[model samples]
Target: MTTSDVMQDVLGVILGGGQGTRLYPLTQKRSKPAVPLAGKYRLIDIPISNCLNAGIEKIAILTQFNSVSLHRHIYRTYRRDMFTEGWVEILAAQQTLQGNLWYQGTADAVRQQLTEIQRSNAKYVLILAGDHLYQMDYREFVRYHIETEADITLAVQPVEAKLAAGLGIVKRNSDGQIVEFCEKPDLDALDELESMPDSDKPFMASMGIYVFSMEMLAELLASPGNDFGKDIITGVLSERRVMGYVFDGYWADIGTIRRFYEANLEMVSPTRPFDLNNARRPIYTHPRFLPPCEVYGAKLDQVLLTDGCRIYDAEITNAVIGLRSIIGSKVVIKDSVIMGADYYESEEDRTKNRQLGRPDVGIGEGSVIAGALIDKNARIGKRVQIRNLSDRPDETHQNWAARDGLIVVPKSAAIPDETVI
Candidate 1:
């Protein structure tokens, strides 16, 4: 089939499950896909935008685990015009006559929603992880899958030894046929999983991006076991034609606090590896027609400032200032991700906050925030220092937590004045 034809017949199934405990505090109120990214967009936007750009219009986001915000975001952002058959919808976990239980794992999540997914009448189902940060034209992926005549085609990327242990490593032959698959193997099993043994990045790690024939997908899901990497992929490797498509691109799995922090800070660099500004393939999100960002005599360096931000005289470096962020004078922010406020605080709101003895939402005056992640609508008080000066590995406080060597302030949290971490 032609590339265009295949793309038209493709349905994107984004797996948006898991408790996402690794990305705690951020994922405490929302799912992994609902987590904020690049200051302005959510983690799910990366995959959804990619699908739209690739002309795969029909999409089903399988969301579970604190997905209220995720569902609302999707409802507000994505909508099908009357002209096209394209539509993006969410398939939440629901109780049916079969059973009333939560999603077991990746495969189980998809299997549970297969009845809804099949309604698209798609020939191929493009399985994608909603929380990953990357940009790819999946039209080529679908076309390649059809051309290869394989039952399964997974997107793989090379990873070093350190990252291999935490990811699903694949062993592919010279012809790109994945021979063996292992999910988070230990040090002893690492050597055997190396696809390019001579190279710096030896092991080929699965990106959790897969393309499966509709029949093959249904067939595999009918069997036992839950996760695709742990059960499905390895189970059908020997009998089925499971091909590996090596993608040498800037891909990141922001499942951990450290990874999430690094991914956000990487955008603040002079040389941006993952550029979000593509005219043809722009990263989309809810268009809140908010006003342009306003800055006042701020000495900024390597910062990503988004919409509706009002910054006063501040020294910010290597940080991502998200939407509606209000940074006061004498504030020093370095190497941090201020997710900003979900809604701007009005004069009335400030008066109420003052009366209640709570700091207004955003970075307070005379505060120093370094190596931190201030979540949305966080109320930081004056003269507060959140640099993790104590250098604690993991410590959970009332409103904040020190994790992965960085201080994380949860959403809508209130921190009083003169507090230090």
Candidate 2:
């Protein structure tokens, strides 16, 4: 196939149906893809933005598990002239010949939406994940696939050996053709590979982004597979021609709570692994109508607070605050992730100790917090004290504390003010 052949009618499909169980309370009400990102975007927006930036207009978002918010956001933000040609659309599971149940797995999710995909009449299909933060031009990957004429092309990155355990490892020949692939290999299993890069750093990690010929995806799906990475991809790794596209760009799998918070905090730095300003490929998210964030008598440094957020005499450092959140007087929020929105102790009640919202979690009018994540729509009391750590190493707490001392507060929890530890 020539470059033009692959690019002639490219179809973009995003797998956004996962339960996001790892994110727990954050995913309590919303799907993983709908989770707030950088206080201004949703996780799903990253891949959609990549598609638009790549000049690929034909797209389908496959979603399940509390997808209303995800659907609404996509519809509201992207329903425009751009989608008229090979437009962007949402493909939810409906009653079909196979079954009426929800998606069984990643592969099944796509397979279930075969009818919608087939309508595109596209020669190539790009499968993507909605729970990641990165920017890549799919056109480049498509061009590479056409040049190599490989059955499949996978995007991979080099990560530490320990971290690679959770991801699939690709073993490629000198020509970049993948010979063998391992999904979540044990620590001792890597010693057998001769081509594995021998360095202080570890081996490569799978980015979960794939470019597949429409025929190949259809054939693979028909051959009996439950999941994408675990079943279909691995089953064909050794039998068919598969190539690995080693990606050196910024990428993070927001699969867990700690990872989700860490990724948000990383953005507070002046220089981040992922640069959103790159004109070559820009990231996308839902648009917010709120005005610019206002900070008055607040000390903010190395923080990313979205628009419509109000900060009053608060000291915030190294944090990511979502839209429409408010920080009250003389409060200090440090190294945390705060999703926006307001709530109330009582719909008719509002007081220093009774106010509801992000800043409503009162800090005793003067309290300190470090390394914590406060979810959206929470009511916190004034003069209340909460920290990520305890001075006594032997003490046991109900909260889950990360190895780096980050504390997580469940979403929508009512924290009374003047409550001290």
Candidate 3:
């Protein structure tokens, strides 16, 4: 089917209500979907862009916790023209006489916003997570769903056995009919759900992207379930016609500090699976008319340097540098994701900061940061060291933290000189 034909009766719903406890500090202030990604984009942009590119423009983003930033971003970035019927709207959790509750889970978030979703007059609902990193043509996914006559279609990806345990696993027969679905299965459960015919790919993991017939979704939500994986998908597998569409692409659930860090780093690699350079399906974001990034005497390799950064005599390798980052001389940064400053400090701002005894925004001189995620507007003093020496799985220090062996300096945090993490 053509793109227009597939998108005609499809409505997009992006679930952005999760607290994202795993990606703390980043999500500490903003919601998971509002978290900055790949130096320039936000996590919410991935699925929204995919929907727009697929010609499905009627979209609703559901948000709850710390949704101020998410709301602001959506308002500023996605202003549909008056002539167009397409729109991107936000559906925040609210308290009414019916109930006073927040979003319980993914399915619950959508359930609460059913009033808005039902107004679209669409036959299919394309549900997407707001925190994953991948590029997909939802047109094909929707077409596949229609061809199979599935009541519910899940986008599944072939994952290695080691990483399969943490995701929702779907076991399908040769005809692609989903027979069983397990969410975060244990070793014993995984063995039973292993791929049929036993090929190299032993597991089919759910990508958290689903297409549901609007009628089926409404009926399912009428019951008392809150989550898609834990409750809805598992509960309906027996009685419903469900199918799995296998996706062979780079998809990362950037819900944790480590996963978020690793995905950003992977974008700077010479050969990465996710492509941000696709002109046909470009990722859209808020347009900023900022100056080009400036690098002086810096030795850089495998780096993605965003606009309005100023680097001087720094040695950076295998890093993703966000916008308006200011790096000092003799600084050595490796394997890090620097979420750059929100705004550049003018001379007056710098002078006031100095008078107030506050360090400038960005890295200080002679500092070393490796395997770290430097959040926006962080001020690292001179000679500060942030390499995770302890390699602890998780630890929280003052203004900074370590999760899965990666150091995370929260937004606007200040690290003093000679400090080491």
Q: Which lDDT values do the candidates have, in the order given?
A: 0.91, 0.76, 0.89
TM-score of every candidate = 0.98, 0.89, 0.97
Models ranked on lDDT: 1, 3, 2
**On lDDT, who's better, 1 or 3?**
1
For model 2, residues 84-191, the per-residue Cα lDDT tens digits are 675779998788776998899889889888878988998889999989888886778888887898898988777777676787877767788877678888878875
Comparison by lDDT, 1 against 2, better one: 1
List the candidates ranked by TM-score, beginning with the highest. 1, 3, 2
> Candidate 1 or 2, higher TM-score?
1
Model 1, residue 151: displacement in angstroms? 0.9
lDDT of 2: 0.76
Pairs in steric clash, model 1: none
What's the count of clashing pairs in each model shown? 0, 8, 0
Tens digits of lDDT, candidate 3, 261-319: 88898889879889989998999998999998888999999999999999999999999
Candidate 3 C-alpha error for residue 77, in Å: 0.8
**TM-score: model 3 vs. ground truth:** 0.97
Clash pairs detected, candidate 3:
none
lDDT of 1: 0.91
Residue 331 of model 1 has an lDDT of: 99
